[model samples]
Target chain A: MSDVVIAGVGMHPWGKWGRNFVEYGVAAARAALADAGIAWRDVQLVSGADTMRNGYPGYVSGATFAQALGWTGARVASSYAACASGATALEVARAEILAGRCEVALVVGADTTPKGFLAPNAGDRPDDPDWLRFRLLGATNPTYFALYARRRMALYGATETDFAMVRAKNGRHGLENPNARYRKAFSVDEVLASAMVADPLRLLEICATSDGGAAVVLTSAEWAAKRGTEKPVAVRAISTVTPAFPQTVIEMPNFSTDSGVAVPDAVTPFKSAIAAAAYEEAGIGPEDLSLAEVYDLSSALELDWYEDIGLCKAGEAEQLLHDGDTAIGGRIPVNPSGGLACFGEAVPAQALAQVCEVAWQLRGQAGARQVEGAAVGITANQGLFGHGSAVLLSV
Target chain B: MADGATRERVPAVEGWFSIGDAPALIGNRCTSCGTVFFPKASNFCRNPDCNGEVFADAELSRTGTVWSYTDAQYQPPPPYIPRGDPYQPFAIAAVELEAEQMVVLGQVADGFGIADLHVGSRVELVVETLYSDDERDYLVYRWKPLS
Candidate 1:
């Protein structure tokens, strides 16, 4: 495949803006265009990550963003892969550019969440697994987080204090990130003292839903070369994988696991398989990573991602944190952009926001949060409803 | 001989569990390969190695150890109907069936709290009324401490 490069990236700071998603998307799109020094009309394709939470317009995000950008008559595509929406959107733009179908593509994902735990869209569709989970088990998103948090504590000896450490580290970084929603630094005491959202996971250990937007401009490396764009970070690989059969772990939207009797049972866990696919595609192991941005929907999940991403051996993530290996200046910094703890999930926007952070760090543009001499970076996120996506970028 | 007519006990989700004294979860087992599934997979076995397309109805283990548990302090949004009035928090548990070698999620039986359970505590499945309306009592499976 030909090299596809990110020309620019932009985001509307994550928070409860109470504004329409269209406004957030448009603002980010404009910022990306300006950063790339390219005109909106110059784009040949517009790809958007659809947000299902907000009504009708959110469903047709491509047309919504295209019309907002003055209808340049660009080829538009909208993708929805739950939380992986943004990374999947990036995949769409990359495919178009690599196919030589478009010289320039703009990808955007944005959302404005209402206050409180996210619920299934108002409906009585028992056929939908998401609705079924809530109606049947009352398994809210945090409920699943609690399950994993408790499991990690039981299996790995991870303490509530270890979970608190992750929050403190991410919260400290969030203060340096201008676009972070929660800029206040969190201490271990504060995190532990916060009322328990679920047993084993305090309120501060879990991520909240909030409004945000992220956008990226993609073009062929040749196009960037012609435009004199210097040191552009290029997409080396994008892995969007599904669970292998006999998926052992209990993921969202499933009440029970596939029985192990039929097959020999997978030696590889599902989440590890997600990152492994990316490494294989990029032809680089975890050792090559200068930094990584992983989905930290909850603090415990971040440690799971550490092992899943091969940052350490299985069940060794807590020790990695205690050793400060994942800190900003540590061996391989993870979530330098503050992750979901600092930037509450915008679902559609969060994955690409991860990429925007990687891009900025790779280009040495990330100010106080910059990883010294950062080069190769990767971002991983798992979306509900069977979407596992990871993207590898290098300058 | 009657207390103001009669109300039917309904399965909240049909075909998931048994209705009698030897109550067990109803699941499907691949006859050829012996792979078992809960919530009864009406389709093919999920195992990639299994070519077995035929499934037989099987009764899952009635007792299992608690794999993990949590409490919903906040009222879960709708489709999950609350009993009434001031919302009460409820404990939920994930139990690992030894025979099936899989974990199943269910609400804790009425009157059980997080304090009553531990990671390896043995529990048995029982059908209980989840919520009731004027005409019917909606029944679903709950995990109770093995007495």
Candidate 2:
């Protein structure tokens, strides 16, 4: 597939702003258009990441954003894959540009989240696994996080301090990020002192829901050249792969894993498969990565990503943390935007926000939290059910 | 006629499990490829390579090893009814069944907490009351650590 240049990227600062989601999306869209030096009317396609919390307009986010930016009669598309919504929308726009269906496409995602643990929609739908887990098992999101954290403790000998180190590192990284929700740099002591929501995982260790928005503009390389764009960040690959059959890991909202007795286990586990697909498509290995933005729903999850994305082997992620390899100035810095640890989670907006941060870093525009000499950057995230997303970007 | 009167024991979600002396989770095995599904897959087999449309009721193993465990320190939101007035927290376990080779999640037996559980610890299935209404007692499967 041909590369599509990221002409511009923008975001509304993530916070608990209790306004309508459309407002944030429009603000982000306008900012992205301005950054691209392209008029809204010049865009040929509008792709939006849908937010479930918001009402009708959120469901039709593509048309909603296009209308908010003033109806330009542009073709529009909306995508929803839970937290991977942003990347799914970006993929749609990239495919449109790559297929020669459009020269320029605008992608946007925004969310107005409710406080506390995200719950299932109001209904007694017993068939829905998302609802069944809550009704029968009372398995909230943190339950799964804690399970993974404890598994790491049991299998890899990871300590609470190691998880705290992840929180502290991201806390420090987000201190200089204006777009981050929680900017205060937390100490390991402070994270350890926080209330335990689940065993081995604290309140500070897990991400909260937040309101935020992110937008990006993609154009054909030829279009970018005509606009006098220099050294634009181009998307090398986007992977929206699903898990192989008989997936053994107990993901969120599922009562049980697929039985591995009948069939051989997948060669790569689901999370590892997500980034492996991207790396294969980009024709680059983990060694080529200058930085990464991974979905750290919990502190320990970030460590898992280090291994999943092949930054290190399983059980060696804690050593990577202790060596400061994942810190901003260290080798293969992960989550330089402070990750979800500092950003909370804006669901649909999050994946695109990762892209926005990578774009800024590649262009040397990230003010203080910039990863120096960033070239090849990757974003990895997975949503509920089987939606896996990863994007590889380079300059 | 009184609050203490015998109440009908019911599965929290019908058809997923059974209530008896040897309470077992009722899963279905694909007649063609031998793939098993919990909460039963009556519609179709999920295996990508096999298109087995028929399944038979298979009783899952009563005992397994704990894959992982955790406790809910706070009360969960609705759809989950609290068992006590002040809301006592409960421990949960994901147990790996040897026969099916899949990990299933459930609440640990009423008294067990993170203190009493560890990964790979042996556990057995037991049916217990999850919550009770005026007329019905909702029974759910829980895991009890084998001493």
Candidate 3:
């Protein structure tokens, strides 16, 4: 596919909007449209990350935002990939633009999460795996992140200090991001002193459920030239890939993992597997990446991404961090926008927000927290329950 | 079921499990490419390559090692918990059973908090009752250190 340029990007500073999701979505969409220098009627397609709307059809969300944006008669679609929802929406929009389906496509993701621990939908139904996991087993979300954190500490000699440093590093950058939810820098002591939610994980180490929104506008490279004649930041590839077969070791919101009983499971662990797919499609390897925006749901998970995304050798992420490689102004800086740790979990909007950060850094437009001379960048996130997404962008 | 409140041990849906300690968990295996799915898939196979009837009954390992473990700090809302008040925390873990060469996640015993777990720790699986309310009951499985 030809390159799709992200002509315009926008966000309604991620914090509790306490408003309907569609409204935040519309506001972000209009902001993106304005940034693209395009009128509302100029866009031809729209896509959105699906939200859990009570009394909705299939949980689809695109048309809702379309209607809120005044029903411009744009071809619309909705996508859901757990935490990776925003990137999935971006993928669909990029596909349409590259396939010659539409020149200007708007991608938006927004959500206002309900208070309390995220649980599965209602119904006595054992038939639905999401509900069954929660119904049969009271496995909450943080427990999953804690599981991975524990695995890393064991396999990689990762220390609580390593995890704390992640928070410290990201918190420092987050303090600079006006769009970030948590702007105050955190101390290693603060992280350790926080209440323990899951073993080895304190409340400070985990991301909170948040209400926020982000949006971006995509158009063909040809369209980009026609509009402004300068080199626009192009979306080189989008990878909304899924997990390999026999998904063993229960994921979040599940009682247990796939039994791996039917056959030999695909060997690559889930996150790295997704990165491999993205790299293959984008025609670049880890060495090619100037920086990355990874799904940092937890501090340990960020280090895990260093391996999964090939930022470093397996089990070497902690040392890489210690070497000051991933920190801003260091080699291959990561999560310069502070990630979910600083931004808070906005569900669907989180991934798209990552893409926005990449676009800014690639164009050398990011103000205080720019990755110096960053060019080629990638954003990797996996939405739980079989929805995977990744994107590679270049200037 | 000892509690007067936990939901009945009614399987939310049918065909997810067979009755026994050696209870071979059943799931849909793709007939075309021989791919196995857990939590059972009666629908299509998720294999990136082959397209075929994804149906099969597969047995999972009954025992495994602790890949990792954590505990709930806040109370989980229903359908995870039937009743809500004075949120009591619980332990959860991911177990790596050598036989299946995969990891399984579940709750650890009620009191096993984060301070009590480490990676590569040995654990065993056991079917345990979750909530037992008046009309129906709920039964789930958990993993604890083999010690």
Candidate 4:
């Protein structure tokens, strides 16, 4: 497979901006186009990540963004995979470039989220599992995160302090990130003192929903070379895999796990399989990663990713945290862009933002958070239902 | 009989759980593969290996061990009606049934909180009133710790 060069990337800073989602997308798209030194009319394709909250326009995000930027007869496609929407859009653009169908493709994702826990569309539908979870058990998203955190404490002897440390580390890492919404550096005590939203996960440890946008300009290596683009960061692999059934882990928006009685459990659990496919395709191991930008929806989930992405053994993630191996200056920094911990979650825009951060780090443009001499980076994120996404990039 | 005292009781989600003293979750077992699904898979078996289109109602084991547990500290958004005014938070648990080898999530029985539950603790399914309307009392399954 030919490499797709990340010619440029841009973001509309994550926050409760309360503006039209299209505005964020347009701003980010224009910035990315300007950064790439390419005109919007010159682009051959526009791939957009869809958001369900914004009515018809969000559903047709590809056309919405294309129209917002003024139509240039670019072919458009939109993808929705909940939080993994951005990566899904990126995959769509990359596929077009690799297939020789389009030399230049632009990927964008933006969202304007509502306040409080993201609930299912107002309804009395009993068949929708997402609604059933909220109606029957009042299981908010934080409920699931707390369940995982409590289980980690029980299974691996991880403590609340260990989880709080993750928040503190990311807080410091994101302090210098201009695009981050919450740039305040938090102490472990401050995190522990915050209101408990769910047992074992305090208010500060959980990510909030925000309004933001992210976009990337991708071109074939030949196209980049033709433009004399020097030292372009290349996307080596993109993985959007689904869980093999009998999925034992209780994922979001689901009431029960698949029964493992009839079929033997899948060899690699859903989260582990996400990055494994990326590494296999990129022909690189976790040891080859200079940095990573994982979906830290909760502080504890970040620790979970350390093990899932093959950075350490299953039960050894806590020790990795204790040894400062995952901090910005550590052996392999994870979430050097402060992750969702700092950015909150802009849902559709998040996964692309992860790639944007990785691209910046690879290009040695990550400012103070830069991993010195950073070369290879990977991003891992999972969305509601069974959407699994990971992208691998190298200079 | 028309007063609130004698309101008719109905399952919040019909066919999901049984009524009466002994409550067991109603799940569908794939006849071909013996895979059980809660909320019942009627159209097709979810087992990727099995192409079985037939299903039988399976009464899941009433008792199971707690896989994990947590409590909601705040009231969730709409579609979830608060059981009482001022919003009393409730404990929730994911129980692992040995027979099904699958985890099912439900609210901890009323009056039970996180302190009463632990991983590997035994629990049994019970029917409880989730909320009541003017016409009927909606019933749902909950997990009660087995002393």
Candidate 5:
């Protein structure tokens, strides 16, 4: 199949919107269309990354956005994979473009998250593992994150200060991002002083949920050239890969990780598998990445991403962060747009937004936090329930 | 309602059971591949190649070791109802069954504190009523320390 180019990318700035999700989505979509110098009526296809609203999302999301945009009738698809929703939506857009079903397609993801922990819906549904976890165990999202973070600390000799330094490092870059929710720089002392949310994690260490929207307009290379765009940002790979079977013990949204009772064999952890898939598809290795954008749900997770994405050796993420190799102006800056830790969790929209950051950085348009001469970049995020994801973007 | 479960009640799903003389704790065994599943497989087998007939019937081992544990500091949103009025923080755990070779998640029994448990600590399953009234009893499972 042919490669797809990202003609335009846009977002409605990630904090709380306090309005219906459609508005932010439409605004982001309009911005993308304007950026591409194309009219809404001219778009041929639509894909949406679903952000669960109330309970499950509305079935007709494409039509929902279509209606809000005054329905010009485009081919529509909606995809869900927890946090990876954004990249998955983009994947669908790229598939349509490559399949020749549509030359120009729009991929949009938006969410106005509920306050506090994103709990399972209200009901007594035994079949539903999300509700079962809450009804039976009262395991909040933070608890799971704490389990993983604490495990990293134990196995990797990663310290709380190392975790705090991740925040301080990201916050330094966040201060330069006008679109970020928390742009104020933080000190290691400040992170240490923050109130504890989980055992080793403080309030500042974890990302908060927020309302945000992002959209990308993708087109075939031929379409871009025809539209007089000299160079369009290309998506090298979109990894919607899942974990292999006989999975090891790990905490998931609704259940404890699957047991490996049948055999002592283990599958690659979901995070590493995501980056590996991206590498294979792109025909590029980690060394080619000029910078990276990763889901920093917690400070520790950022460190985990460093290892998972092959930026450092296993259990050596702290050393890389300490050496400033993953910071702005360093060897390979990570999360130069300020990751989820600083920007807060926008759920669905966030992953698509990461690609937008890559596009800007690769185009040398990323002011302040730009990785000097960045040509290749990668974004990594994990969706729920076996849905792990990443995107390798190149200029 | 912080006050009364007497207002209304509904029976839990029939096939799902935590504990009983019949031995509860749901599971699914693949007829084609003999792959076993816990908490019972509702539909087909998840195995990619073996489009097996998934039979939803099996009893889980009562005794196991604690894989890990943690507590929820905040109240969870809907679909999940907190037993006590409003809601209070409570502990959750993963118990590993040697026979099943899988970890199952459950609430730690009441009065079970975090300090009382550690990974590899022995534990067992128990059928506990999460919430009940004259009309219905919401039966659930818990991981209790093996005494």
Candidate 6:
């Protein structure tokens, strides 16, 4: 199969802009087209990441965005995989190009999140697990993050100070990224002093919900060479794997976990399997990654990704941070784009935004927050239900 | 059924726990594989290895150890009911039941905060009124740390 290269990447700065998602997505799409030096009409296919918060158009975002982009009559597709929705869009576009259905594809994701916690759509449907989670136990999203954070502390001797360090490091990187939402630097003490939103996870340690958009232009490696680009960053692999049966971990929107008795137990957790699948498809290991952009929904969760992504051994993520291996100029910089801590979260846009950062870093386009000599990058994120996505990119 | 005149108490989501003094969580244990599931798996065993379609109702352990905990400082959006005058923060806990060998989440009992609990602390399930209306009192499970 031919390699799919990212010819261009673009994003509308992540923050609460109170703008319609269509406008943000369109703006991003135009920027990507201009960057790729391709006309909108020349694109053979378009894919959009779905946003549940938005009404009718969100469900069919590919066509919605296509109509706004002047109806080029290109093949269109839309996907909804919660947090992995953007990657799902990328998956669709990559498949289209690889299948020879299109020579060039445009992928886009955007969202304007509501203030505070995200809730299920209005209704009294008890059958809806998302609704039952909130109505029955009041188990909001943050509660889940806190549960994981606290569990890490208990099992691994991770401390609150360690979580604070993640916020501080990301805060520093955020100041340099103009597209980031919270650009101000925060001290460890400041992070600790911030009001506690969930036990063991202060408000500073959590990512906020925000509005943002990201887009990418993708083409076959041959086409990129034909376009005369000396070197185009290529997506080596995209892994979208579901959890194994008898899921032991208590994930979101669930009151309980699958029983573990019948099965001996999974050697690799779901998150680890997510990244491992990507590495396997890319024929690369974690040691080969020059940098990583992980889903830092909470500071403590970032540490978890370290182990999941194979940057470190299990129960050793805190040590990796302490050794500064995850810093911008460290052995393997993680989330040098400042991560979701600084970007907050724009849902569907976030996965693409992570890839956008890697695309820029591998191309040496990330200005102040650039990881020196960056060549290979990986992005890891898990969605609300069972969607887990990872994309490996290399120059 | 505490009192004949007491307001009708309803399980918050129905089929979770029954109304009684020694209330235990209602769960399902795969008859063929012996895997237990909370919130009751009705159809089949979730284990991928075992394709057991037979499940029997099982009562989970009433007491467990705290696996982890948190406090929700902000009012979670609907459909979580906020009962206070202007909504108050509440503590939540993830308890690990030894018998079932699974962790379950529940709100910490009233009067207890995050500071009052820690991992490995013993906690027992207790039915408490989550919210009440003119018709009935909505009851849900809470985890109470043993003194």
Per-residue accuracy of model 3 over A271-353 as CA lDDT, tens digit each: 77788888888788889888999989888889989988998888999999999899898999989999889988888888999
Residue B61 lDDT in model 6?
91
> Candidate 2 on A121-200: residue-level lDDT in tens?
88789889988888888899999999999999999999999999999999999999999999998899999999999898
Per-residue lDDT of A1-395 in model 5, one digit per residue for the tens? Answer: 33788888788888876777888888889988887888999898889888777334434556667778887878899888788988988988888888888999988888888777777655567677777666655666777777667668667788889999999999998888877888888899999999877656788988999888889899998889888864588889999988776666464674645545443444567789899999999899999999999999889889999999999889988889999999998999999998987778888888988988898888887789888999889999987677778999888
Candidate with more favorable, higher TM-score: 1 or 5: 1
What is the lDDT of every predicted structure here? 0.89, 0.93, 0.78, 0.93, 0.79, 0.90
- Per-candidate interface DockQ score: 0.69, 0.84, 0.50, 0.88, 0.37, 0.76
RMSD of each: 1.8, 1.0, 3.5, 0.9, 3.8, 1.9
Q: Rank the candidates by DockQ, best first.
A: 4, 2, 6, 1, 3, 5
Off by over 4 Å in 3: A54-60, A229-231, A259-262, B1-60, B82-86, B110-117, B134-138
Clashes of each: 0, 0, 26, 0, 7, 0
Worst 10 residues of 1 chain B by lDDT: B41-50
After aligning candidate 5 to the native by TM-score, how far in Å is the CA of A355 from where it should be?
1.2
- Report the C-alpha displacement of residue A223, candidate 2, in angstroms: 0.4
Candidate 6 chain A TM-score vs. reference chain A: 0.99
* Clash list (residue pairs), candidate 1: none
Candidate 1 Cα misplacement greater than 4 A, ranges: B5-7, B31-33, B43-45, B48-54
Per-residue error for A109 in candidate 4, Å, reads 0.2
Q: Give residue A273's error in model 6 in angstroms.
A: 0.7
What TM-score does chain B of candidate 6 reach?
0.93
Interface RMSD over true interface Cα atoms for each candidate: 1.3, 0.7, 3.0, 0.7, 2.7, 1.2
**Which residue pairs overlap in candidate 4's backbone?**
none
Fraction of native contacts under 8 Å reproduced by each candidate: 0.63, 0.72, 0.71, 0.83, 0.42, 0.82
